[model samples]
Target: MPLDGQLSTLNRVYKDKDAQDVLEHALNNFGDMALVSSFGAESVVLLHMAAQINPDVPVLFIDTEMLFAETLEYQRDVAAQLGLTDVRAIRAKRETLFEKDNENLLHLHDTDACCALRKTEPLQRALQGFDGWVSGRKRVQGGDRQALEYFEIERPLGRLPRAKVNPLAHWDRDDLQDYIKAHNLPRHPLVAKGYPSVGCSPCTTKVKTGEDARAGRWRDQSKTECGIHFGANGAVRAS
Candidate 1:
């Protein structure tokens, strides 16, 4: 089926359904589906829900090599707590890193290029055999994602287009907090230190009291995303 048709059907069927329902439906429909998670502040909500439905579902975690030590530890702890047996840690190739960012300071001059070298490229390679994947993006996150849908298509770099499912597209911070509290899920360690949104170590900062949740990420930069999510026009919005 075409991308639009697939999106329309998926939205129609799972439109009013909650995140868990959308996830369950997607996992059953897309046999080779996987969950691509950052394991950031609110990642545990989706991970826990997925574990409840299918603990064996493939969960892909991108370790950008520049991520905070807390995030790395959280990834391991959350996976074990959720009993997610198929959590795969994807990393950037050493050769590619050496060629693109030999000094690891590429993010200082060009965050997009650094992300392309570390995140987008590696994820594209890791998703080779999957027909579809789920992301934890939410409309409340702001910017381009404010209009996010339950189902979409991601045109990743150097990879065939694949179905991208955003099960928590409509969820808000309160909804996530409630879910986590209800389930007794563990949160990323940095959350308490005011890092509402965690990404790479250098790029991520602490959000102030009145700032947006994601204001800390890539602070003082025009780059909103790390070149992973796709735009509505089927282009990779690598920034």
Candidate 2:
């Protein structure tokens, strides 16, 4: 499908639909689709909704090897609790890390490079078989995401462009909180400790009072994302 045509169809069909409706459209339309989850704060809401729609949908979770142990545990717990049948753990190649970042201090000199290696590369490889994938990003997170849409397009490095579905693009914190509480979904352990957004341990810090929800990630740096969702400029053009 042409880019504008796809966008037109998506906007027309899902402009007023909810997150669950968006997931249903993606799952029904795409032969190969997966749900990418960080199992981070508020991640459970999407996971729970996906499980309700189809527990067998593949759920991709990237393990950067630098993530907190609690995240790993939470990944397991959430999948088990939701009865998610296909929770795939995507990881960076050991050899690549050994050769390029044996000291494990890449983030200090170059934050973008570290994320590209630990995150973007691995996810691209894992997604080769899928035509579209789901994300939990929302407009309320701010920054470049303030105008997020229900469905966008992404072209990962050296891979074919694919549809990126953000089911919760229109959802907010209170919507997520209420859904989780109503469904009794399990929360990521670190959220209670002040980490509104969780990622690799060394780079993630707690968001201070009155700070942006994502302010803690790469705390001192200008980097707002881990280079997985969008390009360096935080723009994903239609494919």
Candidate 3:
């Protein structure tokens, strides 16, 4: 079946089912599907879920090298605690960085370009052999995420569209917390400091009370995604 057709059938079949059911279905059908995680504030929930289903499921952690030290530590701790065997650390080639962002100051000038060099490009290369992947995106996050579905197509430009499974599309903030608490999942250290939506340290700020959880990302900028997911509106693209 075509990517769109597969998405339609999957979403319809699992429309009212819980996130676990959807995740299990994806793991069974999508051969060699990787779980691409930021391992940020809410990542441990999905990480735990995937661990329960299959501890060895490949987890791709994009190490932008610009991330907070806490995020790096959390990634290691979560994988160890959950027994995730194949947690891959993906990063841009050192040569690429030397050519494009030697100073690591590209973010200070062009955020998108910096992301392309450090995030989107590296992730795409790491995902080359996979049939599809999973993400922890939830609809309650708002903005481009509000219209997310159980399954969607992610075209990484120049490559074939890959199946992107979003099992947590319908889950809310409380749902994540409840799951974490129930599972005794370890929380990311930065979350206690008010960085609700954690990203690269240079681009992330502390969110104030009453502000959107993601308000801290890119601070005063209009950018949301790091471009690894897809085009504007978040990942829809030409096949």
Candidate 4:
């Protein structure tokens, strides 16, 4: 079957099922799958689930070198607590990093370009040979992600078309918290300090009361996403 046909079948069957069921189906059907995680406030829910199924499943972490120290620590602590042996830290080449952001101020100049070199490009490289990838994106986050799906095809430039599995696409904020509580999962330290959505250090800020979970990210700027995800099928609405 073609890629679209397979994607449709998977979505049709697992779209409304439990998140773990969706993840399991993706793992069993998509060969060489990897789970990309930020180890952010709500990341432990998925990481814990993945750990339950297979501790060795590759969990890709994009270390943009601009992340907060707490995020780095959380990444280590979460992986250890979950016994994820195959967790891989993905980073951009030093040479390219210097060429693009020699002063480490590309984000000050152009957030998109900074994310391109740091997060998006490096993750694309790390995803090579993987038939699909799992992410913690949720529709509750809103904006472009409000329409996310359990399964969709991604055709990044210069990369093979693959599946982007978002098991939490339909989960709401309450649902995430409930899961985290029910499982007694490790929490990102920043969450207690108002950083509901953690990203790179320079870009992320503490969310103010009554603001969205992601309002802190790229605060005062038009940018929301780090540009790590998108697809050719027009489902991804990043901007």
For residues 67-160, write the lDDT of model 1, one tens digit per residue.
9999998999999989999999999999888888899899888888888888887887888899989999999987788888898877664567
Local distance difference test values of all predictions, in order: 0.87, 0.86, 0.89, 0.87
**Per-residue lDDT of 65-163 in model 2, one digit per residue for the tens?**
999999999999989999999999998999999998999999899988899899888987888889889999899988778888898877556567778
lDDT of 3 by residue, 74-185 (tens): 9988899999999999999999999998988999999988888888888889999999999998899877778889998887657887899999999999999999899888
Error of 1 at 58 (Å): 1.2
| Highest lDDT against the true fold, candidate | 3
**Which is the winner by TM-score between candidate 1 and candidate 2?**
1
State the weakest 10-residue window (summed lDDT) of model 4. 230-239
TM-score of 3: 0.96
Question: Which is the winner by lDDT between candidate 3 and candidate 4?
Answer: 3
RMSDs, each prediction?
1.6, 2.6, 2.4, 1.6
What tens-digit string does per-residue lDDT give for candidate 4 at 4-76?
A: 7889888887756999999988888789999999888899999999999989999999999999999999999
| TM-score per candidate | 0.95, 0.94, 0.96, 0.96
Candidate 2 residue pairs in clash (backbone atoms < 3 Å): none
Pitting candidate 1 against candidate 4, the one with the higher lDDT is 4
Ranked by TM-score, top first: 4, 3, 1, 2
